[model samples]
Target: MPSKNGTKDSMLEVFVYAAQDYGYSIDITLNVHGSLVTGKIVGEQEYFQRLSENFKDDSSETAEKIKDELLKASEDAKKSDNNNVEFIHLKNAQVYVGDTQPTPSENHFLWRGKIDDVNGFFLGRIKQKN
Candidate 1:
């Protein structure tokens, strides 16, 4: 939930903070505005690792640059400690509208969203059959 008593849900904030600091994740489905976003919450380092893997074996300068930048961002996130969780990161993220099924054009991907934007959430994500 966005806010419980004028402040964001402490438990949810703790969840995100733990994921960022401990490299652990939990599958969750969230209601953001009207969209249904479902995914496995992951740490910044794990996110970068998965992303770098996707860009691996590309000899292009652009690919290397992207990987390096992501690595740096991951490191920076780890070092910073504001004690306030601002963003939520997810892997194998799927966003749905209504009852539509997944298509090749709409594949699961990494997602990052503002914690304050979430309205409500559940413990587990909706399993996509793609």
Candidate 2:
């Protein structure tokens, strides 16, 4: 989440699945237009569930809402083709609404940052070194 002055910057949350049939358990931010907001994949399934549950009313409602949000976010992301993945230099990284790094872990190589001030979350695949 992008923050200014040490506050939780408002973000729209969405889910990611390890496989299409597997449950979508990753929590990420989304743009109002329905794109997943960018950030490093630093959290786990429990964290994602907690975050998703926070935004939903009930388990059933949560699933429905998740699907809706995912569809909308996917379409929005597709429409804005320019919003796809990119290489962000970790040392040169910054949040959209703030100048500070989002307290990432060393396990994550790609620092997730917003594009176009749209506020969707993305996972930059770890760059492989040959």
Candidate 3:
């Protein structure tokens, strides 16, 4: 018998493919705190740059849009089944430009707070390690 969480897994796979198609690689980290599950997805800078150049938009805007789509995919997966198992919620979605070093660059973008909030937080040229 298939696991009840199959639907969620399938949905996540779809998101991963979609992200890859958009020239982004998604790294997901899952953390469980009590009854809540938090998932964080980070898209590397190369992908962000490619997406921005392809879409002819600001890198910040492009990153935000990507994060939004990821959050929506996660939410949809959460609601995919009515089972009582824990569902993952997006805790942080971000796009980083340049290598994951402790050096500041003009290409770090992030979206925090609730997933429903369409606004993205731009941490201008901040040092990010991984």
Using lDDT as the measure, which candidate wins?
1
**Local accuracy of candidate 2 as per-residue lDDT tens digits, 10-71:** 33222221211233333333342443233433323223333344446656866778856655
- Backbone clashes in model 3: 0
Query: On a 0 to 100 scale, what is the lDDT of residue 7 in model 1?
Result: 49
Error of 2 at 101 (Å): 18
Number of the predicted model whose TM-score against the real structure is largest: 1
Per-residue lDDT over 1-130 for candidate 3, one digit per residue giving the tens place of the 0 to 100 score: 1134533344443433343334333445322221222224332323333333433444577666876665565455434432332222232333332344321233433332222222222212222444
What tens digits encode model 1's per-residue C-alpha lDDT throughout 1-130?
2234554666777678778888779999888898888889997767777777767889799999998888887777778765666788898898877788632236678888888788889989887664
Q: How accurate is candidate 1 locally (lDDT)?
A: 0.78
Per-model TM-score, in order, reads 0.82, 0.23, 0.22
Off by over 4 Å in 1: 1-7, 103-107
Report the error of model 3 at residue 100, Å. 22
Ranking by TM-score: 1, 2, 3
**Candidate 3 deviant stretches above 4 angstroms:** 1-59, 82-130
